[model samples]
Target: MLTVMRHELNMQDRSFSTYLFGFFLLETIGIAAMIYNINNKMANFEYCLSTITLVFVLIIPLITMKSIAEERKLRTDQLLYSLPLSMWDIVLGKFFATLVNFMFPMVFIAVYPLLFKRYGNVYLLTSYGSIIAFIFLGAALIAIGMFVSSLTENQGIAAGISAVIIALNYYSLDLANITSSTKQGSLLVILFFILIIGFIVRSLTKSTLAGVILAALLAAITGIVYLIKSDLFEGLVPSVMSKISFFQRFYAFVNGNFDVTAIVYYVSMTAFFLFLCVQSLEKRRYN
Candidate 1:
């Protein structure tokens, strides 16, 4: 795993991908920080971090587009398949390789809070908390992107799909607001969500029967609850969506609360997606 990680990182650097990613990330964050802090004289560094996170909608796909997708496309996956390492090792190595690339720009970002503290009184707790959230968010998003990459050999397709999913995660709050708030509406939306989950399972596992069973069970339980207590479903979609909003959690830290739950949520999300990514790759090996 360590060897694979080093090789991946070395390849990324040699390809100029790392430099390009770091350059854009630094430039965008620098511009945002300058505008919000230097020009507007904003006291909180958290706002700058919050604003810069928007770049993930683009940067994540860029970073992960070729992680596994390119390997499959170039038939290098056969090399991976023949290697002595387990699927979990390969998946973890690739994940860390992508994460290391992601972390490089953050090293520069880490200095901003200190710079602000030098200038005047800065809320180090909130500033640091927001930064932590920002990195955690990136870690989770990269894991998602890696999963997307595993689904397709085409880098462009992987990138496009990742961009759309990340964009939805970023804007899910607004989408939830626009969706219906009635009990039936929430139940229907939840059913749709379950179907989507089942579809992903089917896609990864190539097992229609299992997917159908999972979807049917989820829909049945949801329907039973909705029928029993229709009023309980009211506004449930928005509540659930709000809870699922990735950006909103970071905002909590920006508001000066170091939310332990938010940190756990981010870490859980990262682990979940990475697990899925590994499974997706393992499926290919077995097939």
Candidate 2:
């Protein structure tokens, strides 16, 4: 795993995209700092961080687009399979390598709170807390992008797919507000989500029966709850969207609240997606 990680990092070091990712990230933050800290004369560094949260949707896909795609394009994944490492090891190594690339820009970002502290009464503790959550949000999204990259051999497709998903997540709060809040609407939407989950499970396992069973089980449970307490279903869709959105959870930190559940949510999301990434490779190995 370490060998794979080092090799991946070395390869990224040579890629122009890697440098661009750093440059773009820093420039975006710099611009945000100017707007929030300089122009507005706000002492809250977290506001600057919050302003640039959407930047992840752009750069994350850029960095993770080629993670697994290039391997298959060059026919090198076969070499990975034939190697002694397990699927988990290979997936983890790639994830960590990309995570390191993500963090290179973040190290510079970490210094902003200190820089701002010199000028005024900056909320350093809140700023650091938000930064930590921001890192978790990036990790979870990187894992998601890596999984997306594993699905296609084209870097552009991987980037496109991941970017769309991230954009949806970034705008999820507004989407939730516009969505139907009625019990019936929530029930249908939740069922739709269950169906999507079923398809994802099918893709990962390559077993239609397993997917159907899982979907049916979840739908049945949800249906039973809806029937027993219809009020519980009211406004559930927005609540679900709010809970599921990566950016929505990040707002708790931006609002100066250190939410432990949000931290756990981000960690769980990262681990879940990494597990799926391993499963993606395992399916290819079997086929």
Candidate 3:
């Protein structure tokens, strides 16, 4: 695992993606700093953190796009399978390596609070809390990005897919608002989401029977429940979307609440996606 981490870091040093990510980070932080300190004349660093978090949708794909996709593209994944290391080790090694690369700029961003403290009236608790939440959010997204990368051999496709997923997540709140709150509407949307999940299951397992069975079972259950108590489906889609959105949870931190539930949610998301990444690699080995 350490060897993989070291190799990934070394490769990143020679790659343009690392520098591109750095540039994005610099630009995001720079603009946030200008707005908070100059234009807004506010000492709240949490505002800056909130503003820059959206930029992750654009830049995080660059770091994770090549993590596993490049290995498959270059046909090195077979060598990895032959190694004694488990799939989890390889996945985590790559994940931590990408995390380290992402954290390079964050180390500097962490100092912003202290720097602002020197000026006046920086809400240190909320500021630092938001920073921590921001890091966790990025880590969670990176795990999802890594899983997306593992699904394809082409880096560009991985990045594009990841960007779309992250962008949708960033806007999940607005998307949820646009969704209908009616029981029938929510039921239809839930059925659609189940179909999407079925497709994902099929892709991951490469088993049409398994995917079809799972989807049919879930759809049947949803239909039964909806028929029994239509009220239960009322506003279900929007509520679920609001609950699961990563950005929505981060707003709690920005609002000066050190929400433990949000932290747990982010950690759970990170672990779940990393597990998916391991499974994706294992599937490759079997194939």
lDDT tens digits by residue: candidate 1, 26-69: 99989998998889988688888888777888888888889999
lDDT of 3 by residue, 1-287 (tens): 89888888898888899889988997888788888866888999888888888898889999999999999989898888888988888898899898998889888888988998898889999989998998899999999999999999999999999999999999888999999999989988889989999998898788999999999999999999988999998898899988889998998999999999999999999999999899888876676
- In candidate 2 the C-alpha lDDT for residue 82 amounts to 92
Lowest lDDT block of 10, candidate 2: 278-287
List, in order, the clash count of every candidate structure. Answer: 0, 0, 0
* Angstrom error at residue 213, model 2: 5.2
Q: For model 2, what is the error of residue 65's alpha carbon versus the real structure, in angstroms, after optimal superposition? A: 0.7
CA lDDT scores, all candidates in order: 0.88, 0.91, 0.90
Angstrom error of the Cα, residue 240, model 3: value is: 0.8
Count: clashes, candidate 1: 0
Q: What order do candidates take by TM-score, descending?
A: 3, 1, 2
Q: How big is the positional error of residue 186 in model 3, measured in Å on the Cα after superposition?
A: 1.2
What is the Cα-based lDDT of residue 163 in candidate 3?
Answer: 96
lDDT of 3 at 137: 94
